[model samples]
Target: MLSESSRPIIESTLQTIAERINDITVIFYRKMFEYHPELMDGMFSRADQAEGIQPRALAGSVPVFASYILANPDSYPDEMLARIAHKHASLGVTADQYEIVYKYLFAAIAENLGDACTPEIAEAWTEVYWLMADVLVKIEKGLYDGQKNDVIHSNFKLVSRKEAGTSVLDMIFEPADSTVMSDAVAGQYVTVIVKTEDGLRQPRQYTLLPSAQNQRRIAVKQNEDGEVSPMLHKLEVGDIIEISNPYGDVVLGGYSDQDSQPLYLFSAGIGIVPMVAFLAELKKNHSKRSVVAVHADSSSEAWPLREEYLKLVAELDDAKAISFLKDGEGDFQGEVRVESLDMPRLASVYMCGPLSYMQSVRSALVQQGIPGRNIQYEIFGPDQWILRATRRSMRGNRV
Candidate 1:
């Protein structure tokens, strides 16, 4: 619903904004930490700051905001927002902290844009920023409400930890106070907050492994490249880490008419986490649903929850697991190209993975004349590219 009248001005302003991304993010983070240092404990990783990952990620979100404002205002995807909510939820981030972020963000923009930002330009960008913040606020509000009645950090205790298949660690969280850990859908994840040796707090999200509702388990693969995952790998059985209530949009649909439609779930690497959760739900409800669950990993060693996924697919009469690489596997019968999807019969498609893979899958579906409403996916990183994609796609649709 982006108005034709304002679209040109919005796009023109965005060109300048995208160019000053690094400066904006750098100044914004500096000011944010200066005013609110406590947030640094759980939210921003010191290691990532030293290595420049957090700054780069924030810089990348600029274009994403532009694309969203310039294109379909009626629709905003929940994937990126959900990831942030879960990350924030893990560390118990609050609305007050988000307000702090907003102040620094706008202040930095004003400083960086300087005289080049005229009244119209300033107003337009302000509208865009508020719109983006509003979306985030609504999402954050949902997370707050969801966890309102739940206990914090005391229900689950770390039971055991061991390397599962190589990079992934199979860590079990047993109920300490309540035998009923919230029933986690297969594809959903939980945020684990651990106290680092430097006394800085760090949070990381991991996909839950298959288990009865009473026992909550997750596959913690060594994120050698990330700050929190490495710390997570070092934890022991008796160690207690704060667990956030599970929050994700990738869960199974409600028991409506839509539940019976043909469902296709796609995942790459750790993206398979949520897919497993969805499959488990499908079984418990005795769903007569038709599903095609596919996972792509480098090899069997990286195929997290291999046995569990296979077990669910086997029992479900209509489900199948399309594996890219098996045990000592060489190759597949055919490369898992998105172009091969039978879009006409598909009710909905859920996908999670690298952006390139999702983009390819999105393109394939769009090329086959599938409606945008039928396609869904998630991203774990900043989402400025989403705006770029929307702008390009909308312009192409008009032509």
Candidate 2:
């Protein structure tokens, strides 16, 4: 909740703040990192930071949160907060970090705003920041408490490693020591902290693929430009890596209770990660619910876990798998043709991929009579989907 004084102050200056929010956030991260160099060690992703994605994403989230609390006053945006809390929990972001962020972020605001940042303005925005932070802290605490281990990173030693596909490594791990807890629910992701060539510990999140009870499996796609994934690609069967307990709110196969309704799982490229986990469970349970799984990739050989997902779908009596590729043939060729996709009756749709692709799929689903409310999407990076959609909607309406 926002204070009465802060809500108006926020609403009045939101456009200005939003216009320069990226600058404010970039400045905030720079100052915070300069003062607290240790943050660069593990907490923040050096790659995302270098690319300016994380800063810009946080820039969007803060103002959006303020806007929501100001407008609603009673109920906050549950979906947005859930996404944030899950990422925070996965990255082991602590409550105290919010204070550190506040100190620098406000300083950046005050500096950036110059003469316009009055005492009243400062006080009002401060209230908004704390209110948003308080809600996030509470939600993140709940996520941390719900996990098998209360601690952030536990040592997980690699038990198996295989080349799942081109540029993909399937790594499985068990608790390194008796003190470490190992448990992962399907559709969750574990953050792997790896020591880069420069000895910098970079953290990257990978979806928890299906594996044994005492072990965790994750498929790492080597991003040539990324720091962590390339390093993970080189790991041997016996190597150890620091992994977080699986934490994600997008529990796979959690859409509807009724079996008569169809389930649509859509993915592009490596986005098939979580969808595969859901398909594994559905197969294990011998679920008779109609399932339509669509995957798009550069080519069939390039699809990570393609065989695994297809095998799972094959085992399910009421399920079918479709693949789309740019390199030639499949159920649909060229690009993912959401326009040609058959709309199952009242299908519960789950999609994961690049935000733009997800947006396209969402729009197609809407045009095909699938309710927007029925679609669920999970993104690998920061929770800026809310802002991205807002920008897209604004652009769409401009013409």
lDDT of 2 by residue, 76-100 (tens): 7677777878888888899899999
Q: What would the per-residue lDDT of candidate 1 be over residues 78-163, giving only the tens digit for each residue? A: 55555555555555666676567668887888899888767777677666666666777777777666653455444567787766
lDDT (CA) per prediction:
0.67, 0.81
Kindly report which residue pairs in candidate 2 clash with one another: none
Q: Kindly give the stretch of ten consecutive residues in candidate 2 with the minimal lDDT sum.
A: 390-399
What's the TM-score of each model vs. the native?
0.81, 0.94
Residue 84 C-alpha lDDT in model 1: 54
Every model: Cα RMSD to truth: 4.0, 2.7
Which 10 successive residues of model 1 have the least lDDT summed?
A: 326-335
